[model samples]
Target chain A: MSASGYVQHYSAKVSDIYFIRPIKMFKSRFKFAQTKVAVGALLLLSCLPFAATAASLEAQLSQYAATAKAANPGFAGFSAARGEALHTRNFASGKPDTPACTSCHGKDPRSAGQTLTGKRIEAVALSVSPSRYADPAKVEKWFKRNCNEVIGRECTAQEKGDWLTFVGSR
Target chain B: MKFPTRPVSLGLLVLAFSALVFSRAQAGGGHYYPPVVDPVVKEECGSCHLAFPAAMLPAASWKRMMGELENHFGDNAAVDPALARKITAYLVANAGDAAGQRYSAKLLRGVDAASAPQRITALPQWVREHRKVPDWEWRHKDVRSKANCTACHADAELGYYED
Candidate 1:
């Protein structure tokens, strides 16, 4: 806006909120508030990508939880410990090549993993790969494929939620 | 040092990729293969393995492979019929015998395209090239799988598999 127009608007706001202050002090306070607002907006903008990722991941978990709850009224929340166990637990029923999620995803969630075919898989830990679980379709596809490969069938909603919770907590 | 496991829409970038492949081929180098460019093909094929260059195999090979994705190398990689068709078409169109392939010509030598070979690692030329690699190197922790080209060929993601 033109300087004069901005000043007129600023004066209107100043009188409404800080008219009790001296004119000279009001001018300084306005500068401080402007800087604070700019900084606040900048911080919020910087966090948008991360916030969106967090929301999507949480939504995905809740979706699974809802499904699980509907399937079994006794369903409780997911357990990180149980998820961690499932992540590393070996299954004898599935493909021998992928006995467990750890067989391909590696032992550490914070590091990269390698598929049986030697392709690299990004880290599963949300802290290390925050954007990895942002896409519901992509996440569900892998869960279906990998769970079938590792556990011999589609993962239960509880299992999926727990796994996501564990990974996200990481 | 992060390689893009999921390729974006680089179908249009094939010309640039081929230029690089062409230059490397002119150096009398036959170690390069064009990385998969089609996003669908790349993601579907590359998720569990390198999206191997379709030029590495003949049309018959891809045709046979795509026909049996349900038992693909003992993995249930079955996709929807329509999606499978798209992937099959891409692979068949770029197969070593279907396109202007010079690098993979030697690799496919002595193999009848009609036979429809399944394993690129089992290719005669591929075996010959790696004959000198010690068993220990292949058994190394990082290079445990033969398909892990990036384990040794650092630029494997970019299609260069230089010795």
Candidate 2:
């Protein structure tokens, strides 16, 4: 009916279409992106337990490998084959009851073994027990005790690394 | 004959009462050795063998064992000095010779308190109890060591060594 009234109505329509609509659309799209990021973070956090264990084992192996290298000038690296031999070999130097690693650990690394006192030992193979060798202190403690019982001495750094490598690959 | 309900009931009551008293006496003497309740002692000592009840050994025996952890049997079971102290305290406090532990008097019968015998299997009472077990059973693959009390005493972990 009037020029001013027509101009006011046109501007109101323009604001509704251009300003309010875009703000509403942007708000929904922003919420969708936030949901995607939250879900992604949750998935990553779930995988951290396995990843952290694997990284810890890797750290232990590297630490032992370094020690082996330092102990021997011509140290090449750890050998799984050497480890297997060490695992199965019998030596009379140790206690008569436990002359070899296999006496307690059994001949196969993948199978569970039994202690002389009748305690059950979980499988030492990394494939069977992924958490094995993740803790450096525990690994060293067992090596010390078992080597004395089976080999009659502390295990060398090379022997330790080779055993770790062999078990980890299995 | 007339019914003898009164006398029969009295006789049954006496029998039941005697049976209960006898069982309680038996349980208190042998089956009541408390298992290790200390988490530190259980983890440190039980990793290799059943954490033998402290009530099975004298305080002196536990002190000797704690002191000789570096050559535990044949393995190096040396723990940190602080942890060893804690474990030793627990063992000595609950030892067979401790006050109020009358059940272990029989186990400590022939043992010299000064000598501090370490082997539970070597105790006179233990030997007498297990004298019937054949040598083959001790040498069995599953029962390889005398330290393995659980091999035959299925409830040994629960502190019941009853046959």
Candidate 3:
């Protein structure tokens, strides 16, 4: 953030503080005796939105818990290592029509190339911003699309998790 | 001897003043609706994206984005009506608080006035430090953009260093 941006952010905070003060006062006045009840109700209401996010984060964590092993506990880096491996590992169908992930993705995930097949082989896992792959939905869409093209199957969450763990760790 | 109510009145006045300040502060982004996150949002949405740390955007941004799912960035990442309701509920629950800030992907995408690339990204001291690198090095199609510090910088996620 720039000096000007910082100043603006500060002003915005000051302005917000100025605003919420009145509402709190009014709430306290008529509801002084019922303050506990009122605050409890409001807190309950306030917490509703976060429930799903909490659930989502929990579910994701649980999934990780389920498959933290075999995938390699030391796969500690971003899931990019798996994604990198997946990118280069050639599938052995009757013959080796397609090469491994690295065959076209290049040895370095930071830099890869296209194949004769016209697929836009990009870096195994980009962590830059504007990030090349940050949207979870887009990641799923591609996984659905690419897994079929490359490995002829849908990637398991464990696989995706491993890939993300590796890539994000990077 | 009975004490006078002067101190009580003073406390009331102090409380009133503080309430006034608090209400004003709560006026903007703090006016959240509710989070509608659900199984669909968790599974389908979380597939490629960051599951959007709830506090990342103000309620207004979430409302705006949710209301327009059909054209969500040229894609329809919508779910069944019930699931949509659930997802919206989840998002509103964790929406941005005034003190914590509500940054959105769109906001972070460098489109908003505050996050615009030239103003925010390019002017960033870290970016400036790296800006010295020759265009050839950063723009190589191998990765494509010079802004991708993760290309060479190992811990781009932790923090941005001098260009």
**Which is the leading candidate under TM-score?**
2
Return the TM-score for each candidate structure.
0.75, 0.77, 0.28
Expressed as tens digits, the lDDT of each residue in B31-118 for candidate 3 is 2222224556656445423244445454555666677765554334555577677777766566553344443322333334332122
- The DockQ of predicted model 3 stands at 0.02
Tens digits of lDDT, candidate 3, A78-165: 3546655665577763124334545555566566445432234456544331244434455666666555445656677667666655
| Error at B131, model 3, angstroms | 47
Off by over 4 Å in 1: A1-48, B1-28
The best candidate in terms of lDDT: 1
Lowest summed lDDT over 10 consecutive residues: which window, candidate 2 chain A?
A129-138
Every model's TM-score on chain B: 0.82, 0.85, 0.41
DockQ of each: 0.46, 0.52, 0.02
User: lDDT tens string, model 1, A1-170?
Assistant: 69999999988987966755677687999999999999999999877767888999889988999999999999999998889999999999898878989998899999999886578899999999877877898898888888889889999999999999899889
Candidate 3 colliding pairs, count: 68
Every candidate's lDDT: 0.88, 0.87, 0.52
Q: Once model 3 is optimally superposed onto the true structure by TM-score, how far is the C-alpha of residue A113 displaced, in angstroms?
A: 3.2
The DockQ of predicted model 1 stands at 0.46
Task: Show the colliding residue pairs in model 2.
Answer: none
Which ten contiguous residues of candidate 1 chain B have the minimum total lDDT? B3-12
